[model samples]
Target: MKKRIVIFGSFGKVGEAIDRDLKINTNYEIIAPSKYTEEKSKYWSRNNCDYDILNFKEIKKILINLKPNIIINCAAFTNVDLCEEQKAECWKLNTDFVEMLARATAVTNSHLIQFSTDYIFDGLGGPYSEQASPNPINFYGKSKLAAENAIKSIDCKFSIIRTNFLFGYSRIGKKTFVDYVLDNLSQSKPIKVVDSLYSNPILTSDIAKGVRKVIKEAYLGVINFAGNDYVSRYDIAREIAKLQNLDTNLIEKIGINDVEFLANRPIKAGLKNQKALLDLNLKFQNLENSLLEYLTQLKISKESIKEISKNKN
Candidate 1:
């Protein structure tokens, strides 16, 4: 008699991490669907539970049929510059779909856990706390902020987690800032790193744990789940190069003005995690430690792949 959990964007970095974490920590039945894969049906129960999130009819039907206790939404159009150009698609996924989920959750009495971004702030005075007011500078941020409000306006029970600068290993090679730096440096490709903008980079596993705590406590309202260090993008690049023993000199520091983006980005969008620190009683990993652990995991994964290839040969 476990409480069933339905996870959207199940193949994305955060969604996949949460799905993996729950499999180990909780006995709850988990349903994770790939957006365009029929192969996922072999992994999940209920034949109708597919990953087609944009299909409102299918989503509603799933909610009504499953009546899950929790729905963790990690699905979002996260490309900042792309979001500026695709305003309609951005709102449809980030805002409109969230409203639909909020309403459906209300019907099922399911607690909704929605992931968000730190870009909601103007980056004028940060790192911001849970109490800080939101003034989004980009369309992506605006759409997410709207989604947050949509959930809040509904009578449904919900938790919004605002995090920044997420870095992790994606099986599908979906790259983060860490990946971009590592890939470029490993190939001896000269990389231009942003020096002015600052953010706290959190591990995907850490964010999943924080979300688990939120689900356990059924915490309502917004909370910040981010890393401990507030460092520049260039600082992160240097750290990665140092850990991998790569040539740090290949990394060039540049300001925000150097990069041409379709959307306006926040300069200091780091989040303050004091609330999560006290409420969840969870200790967060600093940037250096998190990166070290992630790289170690990556090494192990690579070794495992090599071993499998050797055995086959």
Candidate 2:
């Protein structure tokens, strides 16, 4: 019998990447649920049971029904600025919902895999290891930290994977660093990027592959899943320009203050993937290789769109 895997936020970047991998690469049975029905499988807690993540009773009911062997949580209130304004709402999904999942999964004997962010660390010191202490500078990070602590407090089998500055081709309506740069640069537009903040911008597909390894091994602990390259936003933009044959001068370097973000961001929040590499035997890609791969995906996406248009005509 194949193991049953439940992926929350099945339509999001990480969730969709994991879903694609599971369908193509792995033999596990996946129960991917999203807000809107993307397929015939009726797994959305709201549509099926009229209950969202905050409603513990409904969440428990859904988990009990599925009885999944592994539950990968990719859903969260990820808007950093909005998280600061909507503290209660953010905590409900980031912290409260995770606690609820911990309890429900505990009851069902399921291993829970939760995703976290690099914002949990203060920018003073960074490219942090798995053992580094988290000093979140903003409410978004605080809520995520709260969720991590909640999971730690419980006795349930859980794996916490912390990453930072993810970049790649996201699903429709989702914009990432790569998308932001590519869209503007492709249109011969000038792009201003922050140079102060640094991060290991991991590809979504790479992290998804690493997660598959973790799931297979059933690793129980914190793992810093990120890219090998530590770089600034400006450097990444420049690399993307180079890869796409765009003018490097089109990218302007700026400080973090120039962006005027509502929430405070960590300046040096890159995570070290030594632990993940050593334990899971995963080798993270550098910025150049990762961007090249992303470019190839973009080309494929464009070709597919053209093919669809041709078919329609």
Candidate 3:
């Protein structure tokens, strides 16, 4: 009998990447829920995997019915600014939903894998380790930290993965840093990026690969997973411009405090990946290399021509 795995938020960035890997490489029977109807469920279905519409009650019901061995919770309210304004909704989705998942998985004696963010730390310090205490400066981070604590309090086996600056493909929308830069450059618009804030911008595919490695090795505890390279938003934007042969000078670098954001942001939220590398035996690409690979995968060819055309117009 093969192990059964259920992944929440199957259409999300990291979730989709994990689903793709599970479909192509593994023998585990993967099941995921989507918001779409059965007829329109092609977005979530692939390689004989199961798909269904899921809610809190539905999730609990499914756990009772399927009795999966592992439940990966990828669902969360990740919008930082919006989460600040919508406190109730953010708590409901980010914190409450995770608790519900933990309870359901625990009843089935299943292991839970929950994704968290680097924002759980206030960014006042340098690189954060798994053992570092979290002081969330914003509502989004607070909610995520609450969820992490809830999962930890549960009796079941669980792994809480804290990562930063994620970029990846999904069925819903393109909201990644790489996509944002490419979209702005495609319109020949000057980009303003924060120079002070730094992070390990982990690629979506890399995160998926890391999750698989953790599950395969049965590693337990909080893991700080992120890209090996530490870079700022401005550096990332400049690199994107260089890759597209656009004028790197067009990217205006500004301090984090100068920007008027709706929610507070961390100044240095990069996580050290030494533990992930040593324990999981995983190697991560730098931010520049990851951006280049993302662009190539998206077939953003004729890059110089596209920018020139946009500028000329």
> How well does candidate 2 score on lDDT at residue 58?
70
Q: What digit string (tens of lDDT, one per residue) describes model 2 on residues 19-95? A: 77887745688776555545423323344423345666877788998899999999999999999999999999999
lDDT, residue 128, model 3: 88
Candidate number with the higher TM-score (2 or 3): 2
TM-score of candidate 3 to 2 decimals = 0.89
Please report, in order, the local distance difference test score of every candidate based on alpha carbons. 0.88, 0.86, 0.83
Model number with the top lDDT: 1
Considering lDDT, which of the candidate structures 1 and 3 is the better prediction for this target? 1
lDDT (10s digit) by residue, model 3, range 73-185: 88888889999899999999899889988898789888899999889999988578888889999999999999999998988789999889878765456488778888888
Instruction: Give the range where candidate 1 is weakest over 10 consecutive residues by summed lDDT.
Output: 40-49
Residues 1-313, candidate 1: write the lDDT tens digits: 7979989887788987898888885668888755645554444454545457898888887887899999999999988999988999999999999999999999999999999988989999889998889999999999999999999999999999998988876665578889989999999999998896788889998988888888888888888999999999999999999999999999999989999988998998899988888888877899999999889878987998899899999
Segments in model 2 whose C-alpha atoms lie over 4 Å from true places? 37-51
Error in Å for residue 84 of model 1 = 1.1
Ranking by lDDT: 1, 2, 3
